[model samples]
Target: MIRGIRGATTVTSNEEEEILEVTEELVNEIIAQNSFLPDEVAQVLITVTEDLSATFPAKALRRFEDWTYVPVMCATEIPVPGSLEKCIRILLTVNTTAAQNEINHIYMREAIKLRPDLSSTKRLAQ
Candidate 1:
């Protein structure tokens, strides 16, 4: 079955290095929490806030992982009023047998400020 794993993270700056570091951490954490296998990931869709245009988050993820064959794409998040800034979010479509509740969703860093409840539950360090 196809399952979706969702995650969001925030960065302090739109610099290339900052984008790369935060994106790497976010993607790595999602994969770890969900126990996602490279071959099982159908596709990964990433979105960065409008302020974050220094680099594509998906590109950072690809460089961090060995999944050269996995399909990944990145886009700018819709600029909604009151939306978080310097944020990067991901929706991973994976072929998994796990139920929705069994899948882990991660929100980290200043991204944690966006979801205080979820932050406590997330295991950081990727």
Candidate 2:
């Protein structure tokens, strides 16, 4: 069956390095949490808030060796008046046997406020 995993993270700055660093961290966490195999991933879609334009989050994902075979796309998130800033969100489409409720969705850094219920940042360290 096909499943979609959602994840989000925030960066401190619009610099290319900062954006890439946070993005990589977020991606790694998503993979580890979901136990996702590279081959199992159908596609990855990334969206960044308008405040972050230093680079496309998808560009940073290409630097990973395991992601070379995975197709990734990027877009600008719809800017809502009160939305969080410097946020990068991703949706991964994967083929897996796990049910929807069993899937892990990650939210990290300041983005945690966006979804306190699903945010695992504080829980992991504890």
Candidate 3:
């Protein structure tokens, strides 16, 4: 079965370096927490707030040696009023036998407010 793991993180600035760094961290945490291999990942969809135009978050995924063949796409998030800023979100669809409740969805930094209930599970490295 295919399962989706969701995660989101925020950067202080819209700089390319910040965006890349935090995005990589977010993806790594999702991989680690869920204990999944890169080959199992079917697709990764990344989105950034309208204010963040410095770079494509998907670029960071390529930095992973084993993720070269994984499909990744980036897009802009819907700009709803009062939405979080400088946030990068990812939905990783993977081929896994794990049940939905077994999956860990990570929310870090200010993005934690997006999913307070799950934020209590663990936290992202600062």
For TM-score, the strongest prediction is: 3
TM-score of every model versus the real structure:
0.88, 0.93, 0.94
Steric clash pairs (candidate 3): none
| lDDT by residue (tens digit), candidate 3, 7-96 | 999999989999999999998888888998999999999999999999998999989989989999999999999999999999999999
- For model 3, the stretches where C-alpha displacement exceeds 4 angstroms are 120-126
Q: For model 1, what is the C-alpha lDDT against the true structure?
A: 0.82
How many backbone clashes can be found in candidate 1?
Answer: 0
Cα-based lDDT at residue 120, candidate 1: 24
Error of 1 at 57 (Å): 1.2
**Model 2 TM-score (2 dp):** 0.93
The TM-score-based order of candidates, best leading, equals 3, 2, 1
lDDT of 2: 0.89
Cα deviation of 81 in candidate 1 (Å)?
A: 1.3
- The per-prediction CA RMSD against the true structure, in angstroms, equals 2.6, 1.5, 2.4
On the 0 to 100 scale, the lDDT of residue 113 in model 1 is 73
Model 1 weakest 10-residue run by lDDT: 117-126
lDDT of 1 by residue, 1-126 (tens): 899888888888879998888888888888777887889988989988899888877777668556898889988888999988889988899999899778777888677776665562554432
Query: Which stretches in model 2 have alpha-carbon errors above 4 Å?
Result: 122-126
Q: Which of the numbered candidates is closest to the native, going by highest lDDT?
A: 3
The CA root-mean-square deviation of candidate 1, after full C-alpha superposition on the true structure, stands at 2.6
